[model samples]
Target chain A: MTMRSPLSRVRGLGSAHSGTEHFLTQRMTAIANVPLVLFFVYLLVTLAGRSHAAVSATLSNSTTAIFLLAAILSVVIHMRIGMQIIIEDYVHHDGLKMSLMMANTFFSIAIGLCAGFAILKLNFGL
Target chain B: MAEIRTRNPRPLSPHLQVYRLTMTMAMSILHRITGAALYFGTILFVWWLFAAATSRGFEALNSFFDTWFGQLMLFGYSWALIHHMLGGIRHLVWDTGRGLGPAEREFSAWATMVGSISLTVMVWILGLTLRG
Candidate 1:
């Protein structure tokens, strides 16, 4: 049986099991982002500013659309954990640290959705 | 609560100020710094995508990026992104229990620094050529 404690409110005295989850997810996203980020560079550098129809049509391609969306998701998550680790390391003030952590969460999600929404809009035109 | 303001000053790990600056240490800090830079850069990226998706104001956005200032920022951002990526790769290599030696760390530090810059320069060169 897993040794996780049954007590719900264990005060300030226990290991936070979620740290491993955070660490592993950070690495996982980092691994995924390498290729995704490369594709993203290619997408913007080559195809971004062509004609409107060309851009839209490119996005509509299944492979391009999927990879772009995957890149968006992977990158946003990577950046979030990356920033959170930074804040945890350098920002020692309690309130400020908590606020920045929350802000990082909100910022990552907002941008992820914004990027994903944009890609979907381009792909679907709806 | 962080309890950072407790009356008794707490003992701490010796920090950057104490250590002689080494290639590995510099790369370690640069990794964090570039990571922070890329956070802001991601905002610019998301904005670019949103603009392109909406099909409105896209030209103005792209044109801004075409300007000198935007070009400088993009140059900085791309370099930061690439450097961070290489740094992460080095970390991954170290995570595998290889390349953890002091000399190996220095080698990887040099590799990350040079590799990121070279890649950024090459990519931008090709990108600008394609644009032309």
Candidate 2:
């Protein structure tokens, strides 16, 4: 076997794709999370202890329904993105990391769909 | 195969014990732990939404959350939510490169603690007032 030079051994190891994308995505999610969280906080504060009928009526309202839907969807997406980095950085097995990331994404999408459907079904009086 | 060396000559960096712990350190750890907690807590929101959307009435979801254990979980979640939000604001300030100095970092950490507690108290008071 041909021996490789030390220079060739370390040629591709610079900051060339170094953790920058992950850092940027984390920041992006942080920004997205802010308003979504605020919306959720407001919703919880307003809805606390309301009767079932009143709560249902509020959820049926277009404005509240849409805001809740948007907030929940954003939260799911944000959580998925945040956890992906945590897993990628910590989980050593490449196959496990990929599988876990895929699971996280799918789970978020499923949750988002269910949340959105729930809000819309109530909105249409179904 | 070549025999493996018993030990490396190069020194390794010390772990967590090497540094003194402070409020900032506590806050930093809390931020990540709270993040993970919130990740799980978020599923509850999804469940709530789905229950509200699909069920004929709110009883299903309401009763589940109205239970003692559920209420406890909710309270913990509320605390975590407020704590993490304050931490996020602190992180944003740090992101802007404004609070990395020692004194300012300490102030930010304390602010996170105080703000989260204050918000939690305010929400609980509001909940009780409305309940009454």
- Measured by lDDT, the strongest candidate is 1
How far is B72's C-alpha from truth in model 1 (Å)?
1.8
Candidate 2's TM-score = 0.82
Off by over 4 Å in 2: A1-22, B1-13, B17-20, B56-60, B130-132
TM-score of each: 0.87, 0.82
Most TM-score-accurate candidate: 1
Model 1 lDDT tens row, A1-126? 757674643545354556788888888999998898788776766663466667667777889989988988888888898898899889987789999999999999998888888888887878
Displacement of residue B61 (Cα, Å) in model 2 is 4.0
Q: How close is candidate 1 to the true structure, as a TM-score?
A: 0.87
Model 2 chain B weakest lDDT span, ten residues long = B1-10
lDDT of 2 by residue, A1-45 (tens): 759996776666554565687567667767776777776776676
Q: What is the interface RMSD of each candidate, in Å?
A: 2.9, 5.1
Candidate 2 structure quality by residue, lDDT tens digits, B51-88: 56665545766776688987787777888888987898
Clashing pairs in 2: A118-B53
Worst 10 residues of 1 chain A by lDDT: A8-17
